[model samples]
Structures are given as C-alpha cells and as structure tokens.
Target: MKNVYITRVSKFLPNKPVANDTMEDRLGEINGKTSKGRRIVLRQNKIKTRYYAIDEEGNITHNNAQLTKEAVEGLCDESFSKHDIELLSCGTGSPDQILPSHAAMVHGFLQNGNVEINSPSGACCSGMNALKYAYMAVKSNQVNNAVCTGSERASSWMQSSIFEDEVQHLKTIEENPILAFNKDFLRWMLSDGAGAFLLENEPKGTTPLKIEWMEGYSYAHEIEACMYAGGDKLENGFLKPWSEYNSDQWSKQSLFAIKQDVKLLGKNILSKGVESLKNALEKHNLNAQDIDYYLPHISSYYFKENLYDEMKDNDIEIPWDNWFMNLSEVGNVGAGSIYLMLEELVNSGQLKKGDKILLSVPESARFSYAIALLTVH
Candidate 1:
C-alpha cells in the first residue's frame, strides 16, 4: 500500500453574505406565531453571517454544479490538466439533480474524460466519507491523484413560502405553532459553499498533508432521520415518497425539512460522539497529547459546550485554543463545513511542517461520525 496526502485544498463561497439582521426580518413568525427572531437564534448560536447562493429576492443564483466547479477549479494549478485527476469523489447534502450523480456532473464540468467517480450522499458525513474514499484509492495505488469535493446549494431548498403555506394548512387543526414546527430555523442557519481537496499518492509541491488514519461510526438507530430531502416523515413513522404527492403538494413538502427531535440530538450527540471518537483514537493509539490541532465540524454554537463537556468526561482533553472553527463565518454548511474550515486554516499559514492535525465531522442525520488524523510536512 502507498501513502496518501492532501496536496492542496480550496473553497468557493457565495458572493453575498446574509447577515443575522437580514434574516431576522426575512424569516417571519415561526409556524404562524410570534417566535424568537433570527437574530436571537443567530446570537445564541454565535453565528454572525452566512453566504447563500441566492439573490435578495430569494432567487437561486447558482446551482450545485457551478459551486462545485468553482471550488475544484480553484484547487487546480495553472498547468494542471483535467486528465491529471484519476478519481473524483464528490459529496453533498443536496445535489441539484438526482439523475446525474454529483460526482459525474463535476467530472463532466471538469471535462475529465472518465476517471473513477463516486458520489457519496449522506448529508454532513458525506464530505468526510468522500475524502476517506479518495484516501483509500490513493493508498491502494488505484489512483495517482484524486479530487474530493463537498458542495451544497441550500438556498434553493429554503423556500419560505412553503413553510408559510404549511402553517396556513395546519391552522385548520388549530395546532400550536410551537408544537408544529418553525421550519425557518434551518433555512436561516445553513449557507451555501463548496470546498475541494486534491489528494495524491505521493507528495506534491511544498508541504503535503499525509493521511495517517481515518475512522467512522454511525448511531443511526439511536437518532431518528433528522436531516433529509426528497421525502417527508409520515405520522406512521415511514417516509412518504415525494412521488406520492401532487405537484402543488410536492412544492411544499418535497424539499429539505427538519423534523428531528433537537433535544434528543443535543443530548446524545456529544456523549455518543465522544464514545466513538475515543474508540477511534484508542484503535489508532492516538491521544490528546499527540494532536497539534483539532479541526471539528460542529453544527452550531450550542454543541460547543456539550462537546467540551463530553471530551472532559471521557478523558479526551484537547484544548479549545488548539482547535479551529469557522461556524461564525460560514455557518453550518453540512458536508462542506469541514472542508471550508480546513481551507481557512491552511490559508492562515499558521500550520508548519510536522504538524499533527485531528479532523472530526459529526452529522445530524443518523448521528454519523467521521474522524481522521493528518500529518503536515
């Protein structure tokens, strides 16, 4: 087996930044009742602003493919040819189209004739999985170089009118607004962005990040389907297919929606994640003292304290000062969050030769956890 390393990483964020104040006005009463404004949510979550691939009128300005193309293009060198990439590992929370796999679409955009492509779509964890897949390919000598990307166009799925319409329909039952859902919570939280990494079997120019080891775990049964698209959870605990609904019904219910119990997620995520993380570390013989930096893909500010507490309880003590996070700037970008954070840290030029970095990504859907160890030199 050969060693795999990340030669370069790049990111492409939407042009416009949507401030918390702006969304405070845009996201109206939650579930048709006076609710905490977006500012409160933003402040509580420690998020200042986020980028969206949409215009002022809530019209989508870019699709997934465009965002992905920009990210990948930025990572490529001027002399780099499309054929230089031997594998394309693409992942996303929501792709523009289901027919054409996101990886294949990106491959087409790159005009890279036929390289092995894999599209892993498991919400937030997909990005880490894609990178892991690329690492395995290069480590096994299946590919010389691979490009792994995580992209999302969340604005298109965030149709405020759909939630408003749902609120009106539920009014007949006189259901409590709080009991129904605010729907706009995630709409105001998630942002749009794409991040790409070029991985190679051998070192490239300058310092390359050697992939030490990677591990993943899932507690899907412990958590319900929290984040998803193209289907709705029915009262009978089954997913109601989007095809069953009429065109008008589909417009409101078919897109992304969060019906999970946040309290449950918050309660179990940290403990469950720490347990899994500890196992991975023990398996690889890694400990807090060995890590130089901790790059965590946390969803929101709410989880920060929980994560710290869990780590403390589990005897996994990594100082917060040694961690890097971009939640305040990028919001929770689902699968793209970790990649964007890595790009920002790399661009800061703080990491030097022989740095050991620990990367962890935790997904809401199914409570999936992905962790990796990297060595920079």
Candidate 2:
C-alpha cells in the first residue's frame, strides 16, 4: 500500500465568537423563559467562548454546506485547487436537508468538477471515518488525493423556536425538564465550525503528517444509544427513528432535536473509551510514551481529569505537555472537533521531523470510538 500524508489542514468558524453570558441571547430562552441548566452545563464544560452560524436575531448566516465549502476552499492555492481533487468526503452531525447527502450539498457549493464523493453519517466518529475513507482511497491508489471534512451548524438546532411545541407538551404533563435534559443540554455545549484535511500520496511540507495506522470500534451491541437526534430513546432501549413517527409527532416530541442520556454518558464516556485505546495500543505494539502529541476529541472539560485517571490506570498515559486541546475556545463541534484541533496544531509551527501524533475520538452516540497514529515525515 502507498503511504498517505496530510498535505494541508483548514478550518472555517462562522461569525463572531459568542461569550458564555451571551449564549442565551443567541440561542434564546426556550418557551420564553431562562434555562436553569445553562450555567451548570457551561461551568462543567468549561467553555468560555463558542461560535454560531446565526445572527443575534437567531437567523441563519451560513448553513452546513456553506461552512464546509469555505473550509475546503481554504485548502486550495497555487499547488492545489478544487478541480484537482479526485475524491471528496464530508461528515457532519447536522445537515441542511434530509434528501441530499451532506457531501452532495458541499459538492454543489464547491462546483469543483466531477469527482467521487462519500458522506459518513453518525456522531463524532463520522469525521474520522471520512478521513479513513480518504486515506484508504489514496493508499490503495484508487485516487491520487482526496479532501475530507468534518463540520457542524449546531446553532441551527439550538434555536429556542424549535422546542416551543415540546416545551408546551411538557407543561401539559406538569413536568419541567431543565437544559441538562435530553432536550436542551447541547445548546451550550456545541459551536458552529467546519474543518478540512487534504490527503495525498506525497508529503507537502517540511514535516507533513503521515497516516501510519487507524483503528475504530463500536460497543453498540453491548450498550444503548447515549446521544442521538431525529429519534427518541424508548424505555426498553430502542431508538425509534424519525420515520417511525408521523409529522404531528415530530414537533410535539422534538424528534429532530439533539439529546443525550446524561446518566449513560457520565458512566461510559471515559471508561469504555480508554479500554478501546488500550486495545488499539496493544494491537499496534505502541506505548503512550511513544507519542509526541496527543489530540483527543472530548466533548467537554468535565472529562479531562477523569480521562487522565483512566489512561493512567490503563498504563496509556501520555504526559500533560504532550496533550493539545482547544475545546474551551472552540466548543464541541461534533465531528469537526478533532479536525479543528489538528488544524491548529498543524499550523502552530511546533512539529518537527519524526514526531508522532496520536489522534483519538470517542463518540458517545452509542459508545463507539476511533484512534489513529500519525507520524511527521
């Protein structure tokens, strides 16, 4: 197999960075009342600033496809252009529409000539899966180069107007669900952004990141969904998808809104994740000390200490200095989280030849995870 190197990394974050106190203004109050859990969520997540694709009036300024298109365009220059790309792969948790694939919409905005396109669907791992697809395409000589992207327009889903009907439905039953619930918790936790990576058989810079190996796993068979949208988690642990519910039920239940089972998340998010990492490390005969940089796509800072403890117990602890994170500033951009982290590090001018970077992303959607090892060449 041919070696694949990341030629470039680019990111696009829409509009201005919204501070913590101003989040309520951008997202608005659900049912015209303040969110009781917003402060708690922000405090635990430790997110100081986040971007949104909407204006103060809660009107959309950029959609998912547009954000991703701009990020891909940023990858172009005299050496490379959209027309030169042979494959396009895009991944996102939130898409502009349901009919067309996310990659199709991005391709429409790019108009970069006819090329093979792939869209990986799901939560965080979706983006890594897209990268793997591009990696394999170039590694197998199926394509000379590919553009892979991960992005989110979560502000579109966080709007208060989307939950009006569901709020009323809760009031009827005399139930008050706070923002930490399955309905509104993510509003303060997600930011708007897109990130792209250009992968080719040839290295681009003085120290280009090479794709050494990648490993992904899912524990869905042993666990229920931890985070989800376009569906409701039934008591028996079945996810009733959007198609199962009619139009009337959609608005009443907020079926399209993102939600997470907080209890399940707190329990399994870190434990299972570290287990998978240990397994991957064993398979590759690599140790934590071998890493020069550690990039993990954790949803919040709440897991930082716990993850460190878990890694230490599993004998997979990388030193604190080797870790890099931008979660507090960028928020959790779903599939784009790791891409954004890599983009910043790739441009930080800190990397040198022979450095090793470990990339890990654990999706709480259903306890799935992916880990990759990259080497600077």
lDDT of 1 by residue, 311-346 (tens): 988889898888889999888888899899988888
The local lDDT score (0 to 100) that residue 299 gets in candidate 1 is: 71
Inter-residue clash pairs, candidate 1: none
Cα lDDT tens digits for candidate 2, 196-238: 9999999876557899999999999999998999999999999
- Local error of candidate 1 at residue 114 (angstroms): 2.4
lDDT score at residue 262, model 2, on the 0-100 scale: 90
> How many clashes would you count in candidate 1?
0
- Model 1 TM-score, 2 decimals: 0.91
Give the poorly placed runs of model 1, Cα more than 4 Å off.
Answer: 24-37, 175-179, 234-238, 243-258
What lDDT is reached at residue 150 by model 1? 88
Worst 10 residues of 2 by lDDT: 174-183
- For each candidate in the order shown, give its overall lDDT on alpha carbons: 0.79, 0.91
Clashes of 2: 0
